[model samples]
Target: METAIKVENLCKSYGSINAVSNVNISVDRGKVYGLLGANGAGKTTTIECILGTKNFDSGTVLILGMNPQKERKVLFERVGVQFQESHYQEKITVAELCNVTQSLYKNPLDYTELLKQFGLFDKLKSPVNELSGGQKQRMFIVLALIPNPEVVFLDELTTGLDSRARRDVWKCLSNLKAKGLTILLTSHFMDEVEALCDKICILKKGTPIFYGTVGEAISCSPFEKFEDAYLWYTDEEGSENESV
Candidate 1:
């Protein structure tokens, strides 16, 4: 498959602490790639640098064969992003929010279609603050899809969602993958990563512990459980150092 995004020796830091260190990874076109890591392991920092939202101390980053730093606007046109948190003004109606996002794109997805897909068509008149947690999450995802981007970045997409809502998000993502959108997702949920990613990258302490197919990674372990394999790969053999 052709490459959609590439990073070489990427590094990011805050003050004296390094967030991402010498990280090299690549995402292929029309594939779903998962970035799995423990909290504060630099997954978010790496993505921020790749998307040109944060500057890296060193290394090169490219998206769609264009340098993100040099072609930020052009790159953004083809990329959709859903942040780790959902934050909207309390008074903004769902429809109004969607309409405003649609205006930012030269060619946006039909707002009504998106609302229907997210099951928010009936909640269009409700203010964002009035929606339940699941409904709010659905709204955020609809916003992400409105741009109809070639590449989508979902940061901790299922965090804090109830099981039912999480499953809904997964279904929506599967549909997006079927449509051939390149996806780069960061999640702590091992099962979620395995269920959705075609390929996976495991990060620990600002570095890649492993990068390969989930099946291959699992096969490397003597244990039958994929979660056990993950634990082994991360060097958590009944060690106290292991923490999610």
Candidate 2:
């Protein structure tokens, strides 16, 4: 399979603190790659470096055969990103926002069809601020897809959503995967990763402790559940120290 994103020996620091150290990742085309980690584990830093939103102290990053740093303008046109926290003007309605966003892209998806598929057609005229948490998230997904990007990046996608809403968003994402879109996502929710990700990278203190399929990760750990497996991987030392 062709590689969609690659990072080699990526390093970044904050004065004395190393945010990302010698991190490496490879995302294949037409697959969903999950970046999983506890708080302060450098997941965000690694992603920012790959997207060229932040400068790494040392390393190389390539996105779709082009250097993101040098070809950002061209790269961005083919990539879609939804940050952990996205805020739109409170006064703008869903339809209006879609219209504005579509204007920015050369070849955009049908705004109406996208909204309908996400079950947001009825709320098209509703103000962004008035929408519920789930509605807001669905709207964000629509915006990300409007550009018809080949690679989509979603950070903490289901952060504030309820169980039902989270599942709804999962279905939407699964649909995208079915269409053979390459997706890179970061999330604290292990279940979300287990459900959506074809390949997983588990980060610990800026280092990848585990990189493989979800089943492989779980089988390697003593725990049966993904959450416990993740906790074990990230907190093994802490757990050992506490036991001692």
Q: What TM-score would every model get versus the actual structure?
A: 0.91, 0.92
Cα lDDT for residue 20, candidate 1: 89
Question: What lDDT score belongs to each candidate, Candidate 1 first?
Answer: 0.85, 0.87
lDDT value, candidate 2, whole model:
0.87
Residue-pair clashes, model 1? 0
In order, how many clashes per candidate? 0, 0
Model 1, residue 171: displacement in angstroms? 2.5
lDDT of 1 by residue, 127-205 (tens): 9989887788778878888889889888887777788778878898898889889999998788888889989888877
**Candidate 2 backbone clash number:** 0
